[model samples]
Target chain A: MTGTAEPIVMDLKRAPNVHAATQAKGEALRAALAAQRTGTGLAAEQLDALPVPHRRVERWKHTPVAGFWSTPEAPSVQTIEAAGSEACPVPGLHAYRMVFVNGTFDAKASDLPVHNGVRCEPISMSDADAGSQGPLESTDWFAALNQAFATEGMKLHVAKGVILDRPLLVHHHTSGENNANFMRHDIHIEANAQVELIHWSTASDSSTGMVNIMTHMSVESGAVVALDKVQDEAGSLQHLAFEQINQAQSSQVRVHTGTIQGNWVRNDLNFRLNGEGCETVLNGFFLPKGKEFVDNHTTVDHRAAHCNSSEQYQGILYGTSSGVFNGKVFVRPHAQQTNAYQQNGNILVTDKATINAKPELEIYADDVKCSHGCTIGQFDEEALFYARSRGIGEKEAKAMLVHAFIGDVLEGFAVAEVRMEVEHRLAIKHGWDTWNDTLESA
Target chain B: MVNIKELQASIGETPILKGLNLEIKPGEVHAIMGPNGSGKSTLASVLAGREDYEVTGGAVDFEGQDLLEMDATERARSGLFLAFQYPVEIPGVSNINFMRAAVNGKREHDGLEPIKGKDFLNLVKEKASLVELDGRLRNRSVNEGFSGGEKKRNEIFQMAMLEPRFAVLDETDSGLDIDALRIVANGVNAMRSPDRSFLVITHYQRLLDYIVPDFVHVLVDGKIVLSGDKDLALKLEEKGYDWIKEDVIA
Candidate 1:
């Protein structure tokens, strides 16, 4: 027992072989793109050069995606045609809704009336091609896949000095077995403009589908942009989403991601403070139960002076489920007076559950304040016993504790309807209906 | 009413309450004075059905039912409350919500519906003032960021809301100033009724002065060595537990 331990080595040569089914899917995508004559600025050979995301990569070590490409997938063709459509979950939300069914924007089901200097339109093939220059041309397989096969998306541009009175809801609905879809949304907020945007997606439980999405957002000087994105898909669906944000001088951006329900979900949220005096707040919460796996990866790059960014990502894993949260913050040499804080907290409800949380801060500046911390713990026994001693039974007590654990992150949602909807879903999932009112003041 | 006969218990392999005996009738306040490690807190925890202490031997009857047979939640619903010496801080469970759940839990156990929203709010307002607990504290998380005195006062406020049939004040006066102690004592005194009973465990006679108990028992070495009236507490405080220790040993 006192002897030195041997190091385990993994054979990098044993890479996964490209499946014939995946190659066929790629050929089918190329043919479709060629028939439409849409230029994605990315050559088909470039996408073929990079292998799909797999467990061999350092970032994808915990979550395996090699099987995702090998599975056969077909495009979904369902459409929603009315305001009270069953596809839109948050019904009473008073927002200009853009409903996308099976990756295509349905104008009839949408209530978007371009009134307050805000332009809303579907992303033409050219628009999608223009935004595919950076990572999509490089090592990101998800981004490349989205750019190569994106069937539909939205382009939202808010003019300078305009404040939209209502929020904009972009709803994506998917149905059908073995369905596969890709989408991209580009949001450009001009100087001093303000808007609240909600991106929501749902899928049927019986379908073993996959959806890859990419979003590009730019917040200009003195602008305030708040976004609340929720992904509540089916247990058999696989979701891979990526969002890239850039903030200009003195700009403020608040983003809250709620992975309320999913089976195999991965979210990559990246932020860059390109100008001085910008503030970014990123909050995320995910609950996975019953063998589900969820991963959230976030990066905040501070390239300018006097910029502040804080991230709080948390997860609650139950049953045999597993989760991963990897948050990285970078402070460049010239970015002095940069204050970046990152925290990842997780709770494993059952002994069989697992969580891998890594918070990294790479600081090159000498005069900066950057801190990263991670906590992996279960329910506080004393607190649980305290509640139980007050007659709150075991189940309700556990629900209340979970509510308290994710209370602050839930408060990060900008829209009230979205927050309530997420809370309702959480209550239903955890049998918290009896104690739902306890969350009213939380 | 509560009855305890040779109530023996232990935490792990170490016995804390060895052959301890005590009884309390309706409307009576019994004060147990002892030195540290005399199992004052172990008794309170054992009565509240805390799982940490295992009942090695003995039986406890509360309202004609076996108290040791129920879990903590069942014991709480059966009208037994313990005001923790160091109340745990629940960061997001509001005091108002906690009390409402406790109240409704007991009501449901009695085959009654949950309390109405308006009535619950009124009850919170009335009970919070009993211990001088501010309205803001009631809305905040239970015991989170509360000062020492404020925590004790909040305990009394919860007791007022719960209105248990048998209450155990486990060193409720441990970290209180004179003013806060008087307020806590007054809150407990206000709830004393012919149908209720209390067992106040304290290290000093200072609390018994305000919430004056009917019977005073001296506990040493996990057993009661003397039983007297309120005058015994004054004697014990004046001379300290040294004389009682000598007498018990002899």
Candidate 2:
């Protein structure tokens, strides 16, 4: 175990010079830790051993941790009243709600009644047993930071042959300026069990805040799991999320993520297929406006033979916003008969907006099949002309085309309410009068 | 209802429609026949308000309104339609939704309320039968995976739904077989009324046997050289366009 030093000196050679902001943040974190009390889990000393990410790191190459991690301020506590179901964009959908405010579980705002074949509770650092060390043993900076400072998060377990009738909705709401939040969630689905999860993050007030969340999911043999995540934070907030998924033999897992609004957001998703006959699907859609920045990085490892995976990500950028997508697939030497596919497509609404996308595949088995494709361009002129010639206005035509471009990703959502909510949000973001009117009438 | 005078247009630096003049009154069906490069498509494109062509010296009047000043959507709303020679394929936009948008857009432009959902669907079914279009294809994406004959038939189905005052059929019979051509021509003839007119542009005169145009014009070198009745189209078909070029040179 690494011990905390009195005066820490960061390695400037290993860290990129462009991330001066992150260096300043590290100094602030050290100063804050010196003045605070230590916790039971991975202590501040273990976090000090992990290095902050720089441009040199392959995972963080395009998305530098400058303005997001640096300029840290003392964390502040806030009290929030119970919000109504209207706060949930997809109203009328039956779900088990778990609310968190400023990284602490708000029991009063949550609806966590006991159910059959399932257990749901919040675990603190002191209450977590030695068996919870699997996810906390990671050496990544973000994971270490989460393990060190996480105050409260949900711990869920589903018994064998149990099928959840309603989805689990986890809502994270932040308030107060300069507040930092750290959260961790662990979910385990037993053999032949099925579950659906919906996670959403939003800011209660227009304040500059930072949120770091880590989720660890394990699916046993013959189990099925579906997770849908939506991030619609205020422009003054910064968010970072990491999801680690592991699958057993014959397990099926699907994940859909939508980043409709944010200032600075990054999602790191990694899947480990350790069992043969496993299937995985990942779909993502992001729309950033103004000076917002959004990045999605995903990796799928096919360690066993006869596994399959497919991934698709689409982005629509407007104004001077920037977007990034990096997808990687790896097939080990013994992973024969593995099939993997990846695609990334982007549409820039304005000349000032930009996108950076890279799709990579590594295969050691000769019998495996792997392919990737990427496209970045403006709207099709001929399609626009065809729409206009049918009496559709220019603005409506553009909106229709954009909607069609992302139609596939939207249809991947198994929940109808979630799909409709996302479509409504997209219409409002793009200022489509025709769609707005149609939504109102509907 | 359409009048074109000395319509000189060019795409880039190359001139396509040079000094082309034509006129069509209400309740009249006219045909324009010419060789491959006689600018028949350019005439249709310029009238549809395609921005690629620069109108150097010409004027088009649709019901005495300046057609050149209006944009493509505005022209469609004002009762002008162009059945493209090669219809574009839109993968995610359904054919039914496309027709509803075209119909509702024109209605909205005329200050009318949008059509009801059930009413709009009934309208689509009625117009689809005019061209013998399949109901499955109507629900699919616009022109996606449709055969050549089906694509041409979809164009006519759209025209029927919009009910435009003036329609320019640019080679509607280009890729159709005998049976498909008859179905398409019947769809057009069924829509003919005193308030609407048609401009049938083709390379062969077989289509004239079905729609039976009242006037036929021979276009050569970006200009219409001869104007006569439907008998002239038969004569030109018997003697290829080379004779018309030789007559113009002499």
Candidate 3:
């Protein structure tokens, strides 16, 4: 996995073949890294050794990556100034802000406090070696690319028995056209500690871009952690995110991901229950309009006994957009008395809209209880008519029914600020003026 | 307040209400009783502008306005309400929120400002007590996990909240116990006014016992075959619908 320090330049005159796009991007990325002289700790041989996802791969079967890979690559780093905290989509949530622009940390716009036992600092390539897990072991192509090109990110640590009074808001803003931004975030919550972390990503202007993010989180025994992620990039951009979570004994972790607007978005989330009496909850809501596409693949591994996990993902597709949801729960042989539940529900507004949902439960334990359900349907005609019969207009009634359909997932958010922000975004997406007003007032 | 003349309707090609005619005056309670598949529910549905029941040829005037020309929501906004026999179970929608939307919708249609939150809450509490609806149900999802009796009482509670000028009770007594029936009847009686009327459609005379109707009509084969005063309901209950069916067929 070692190679010379020579730059591997890419040929821009190559034909636009999606099948060869991944190789072409890899070559171009190596040259870009070598030109900047920023060692990524990943050798060219290691990158080439990783397998790129294709149509034949089971995980990438539903979501096509041809267009994503074929898009023109942008420089990894840009000299754009980071927007102020006032520009955050979630107002009043910048109590402790960490801002990043085009994969470059902006200290001027960030608030790095020195709280008791709370540490927040940028992670360099040298520090990446100290982590237990590395991207070379990950089979995912996107994870390898992130490892090769990532230059700016954060490493947050909370000491044992310490609780942060305010949430840590990490803002990732993309600017400039054709920019390829790669980022990595790691969070470690020590034993008996409690903290809330929110990651908000948005684009400053309408531009064709690409964003790749990977997050690794660990929660120690008796700790509580809530991680909320919101992505609303430009419609012409593409995004790929990978999250890995490990929970210890008696620890509780909740992760909420809301995809409000994006052109092409894919989220890969995996949770590992390593100790007994752990609880993990995953809730997601995705809304795609026009020709946008969103796919979510999640896996929960119950490796210990007496663990509990529940996952629910709801999608509302409009126009000619499409969505995919694949949820799997695995109970190991020794994980007896485990409780795992998974549900995926989708609503296709127009006949042109499409959704593919799959929920699977693999249980090897005899005393385990695991169930999974998936439903793809339109709005309930009876419920719509019932609402309309009460003098509510057709549009408002439809919005109300849609809200009701996804209300459970929103209600599952443990953080009040995050939930309200999500509700506000939903109201905007569905054009519920009165509902938006009500949310604002509340 | 409502006048139906030569009302002809059908579901697909199967005719339901065949050239039916009825008149409901203000401050009056009219009961329509029939055996199964006798167009009793069809009449209620057609009046509430259910799209499934096509109006082949009919004209309905409510408060001097053409009712057939209006859609379901328009009819509702124009003060026409239907207490469904089987209220739909809407998950994750609070009962109070649903009621508030209905009230505000009606108010907006009347060119009035939205009701204040405090006033709306007070109204809900006052009207809910009329039907003895539990306070906990107000915050729960609409009709979700509700008992048969609780659903019936919720219907009446919703009716009181909307305060429509005219209400059509379609088999509202189908799944109610004795106590629930009395509470529902008491709610209806309490809402009665000089300018409001009700069209009660039922299969039994027990509901009419507490809230007596001014007139009774027996619908058979999609038409009213017998019309009389309140005595007609008791007579039909005592003799059974078989006699009415035989009379109409004969």
Candidate 4:
């Protein structure tokens, strides 16, 4: 019942000296980007001047970034042995798989299916072909770090009126112990283009690396995009990811972020509705067991009129794990007739577990319907009794109830195979008999 | 068979069932008619091993096993079933999956293999039709958004699926329309077997008219005052419980 210990304050300006090897790698990446004239990299001085967030910062209060950047050894981008395409976690998932190992693109380990009207390739600093100024680039500390140090990522472009038959998968596999990997992915969806994007990560059990990812997406008019991001890294790994989405008029976007297994994970998801008649749907769930910590911060800013956005995020914490969820919705004065709703729900399975949830809504428009709420509660005893009375064991009943609590968000996955894989993993880890798995096998 | 001897129970410090006694042999339907708060539901809950009702002193034997020693799940797996008066509505747990788990749980308890998927599906279809439960209700979350009659029928539907040796129906007739009452009664009647026994607890004699209990007991103040045949129910329905209360007092 006691509060957490006072956060440790670190002198980030002295970080360059301690992490000199990482700084030198960033300089090399900046030179490469400058040579290609991509204009995506920040100057060395600007990158050094960006302040790394600490516990004192308001947004970073719940999730401290100092520990995310701290390591016993100098964190540098390093490549290890590649396990080929068989290393893909979801073997049954059939997608255009692009595999990356320790933040570097592995061409031999990826299946690059060439389809008409789709340009998907590993971003190269030497080639200017897969180049574009992305729609949204955050000046935040984490994004700035990624912009300065990112060495390898993917650039995807879908031509107008093109609908992908299969999903595009960006799979990150980490094997570098005590190392840092920075990745940045750019996605461009032309008008009327429909595509589904899946970003998934897995790491070796012995790897205690740091993986920072920044994703920027732009959707043109009448385009529809579905994004499913899953982070199920090793318990020793630390993960920080930022996603920025810019929607044009009449664009429909849906995003589902699942932090199923991670020791420390922080996600910042922002949506900017820059056009009218756009529809934005955000659904996410996190399961933090043991001593894991997961923090999710999201913002949906409606700057255009006649836009609708709905966000729902929930988590279940067990053992001594803790979680934090902060969802904010801002409806500008000019964005009349905007309907924005946000909800955050959590369940603590153990007395030692905790969850801090805050849902904020700022509606300046008069003729708008906006609602935001949060709920933190324990398991439903009556429901538990009901299931057990029907002959289900207590532990199995609890497992089923936990899955049910997060079912709606998982159902939002654009790919069925991906959903089943994640569900199977969770069931195996939690000793749950997933009925659908049996039904499918039968 | 089920036997109860000096069954005493309570909630907190307040006693609900004070030394009630009852016994049921195989192939018999015994209906206990009582006034409000006469420990009718308490007896049903205690029989089903509901944790909230503590058995302060008493003994319950089910098929040669000490029933009170088992938890609710163990009792259920050991062939004891209770159709709740107010069936719990569990959202996000489909009725099909719940029933499958229940059926498999009992089978495993009896050292039998799990039911085949096709056979389970067939059983669900067959048992559901007994109560006129539609396919949609079978697929939806357990008892969620179900009407009163539908919830009761679902209970009987589950009873048919589980096929427990001893069944307790706690106020199964309340809040039911005449048509639904007949349908529910028909489902229960169809499941009557020589190997199974039932304790039907209700306030009205209306349900007795359809199920046709072999014996009728009048309960007042946590004790049974009189026991009779089917005609006693009609008499109690026509005469109202005042005469019985007077007789007990005298």
* Clashing pairs counted in every model: 0, 0, 0, 0
Candidate 1 residue-wise lDDT at A266: 91
Best by DockQ: 1
What clash pairs does model 4 have? none
Better of 3 and 4 by DockQ: 3
Q: List the lowest-lDDT window of 10 residues for candidate 4 chain B.
A: B241-250
Evaluate all candidate structures by whole-model CA lDDT and list the values in order: 0.82, 0.82, 0.81, 0.82
TM-score, candidate 2, is 0.91
In candidate 2 chain B, what residue range of length 10 has the lowest lDDT sum?
Answer: B241-250
Candidate 1 vs candidate 3, DockQ winner? 1
Query: What's every prediction's RMSD, in angstroms?
Result: 5.6, 4.7, 5.5, 6.2
Per-residue CA lDDT of model 2 for A371-400, tens digit only, reads 899999998888888888888888988877
Q: What are the candidates' interface root-mean-square deviations?
A: 2.5, 3.5, 2.9, 2.1
DockQ of each: 0.50, 0.49, 0.49, 0.47
Deviation (Å) of A288 in candidate 3: 2.1
Docking class of 2: acceptable
Better of 1 and 2 by DockQ: 1
- lDDT digits (tens) for residues B1-250 of candidate 4: 8889988999999998888888899999999997898889989888888899889998998999999999989999998899999999888878888888889889989999989899999998899999999998988898999999999999999999999998999999999999999999999999999999989998899999899999999888777888999899999899988998888657
Clashing pairs in 2: none
lDDT of 1 by residue, B1-250 (tens): 8999999999999998889888999999999999999999999989988889999998999999999999999999999999999999998778888888888888888899999888888888899889999988988898999999999999888888888999999999999999999999999999999999999999999999899999999888788889999999999989999987777668
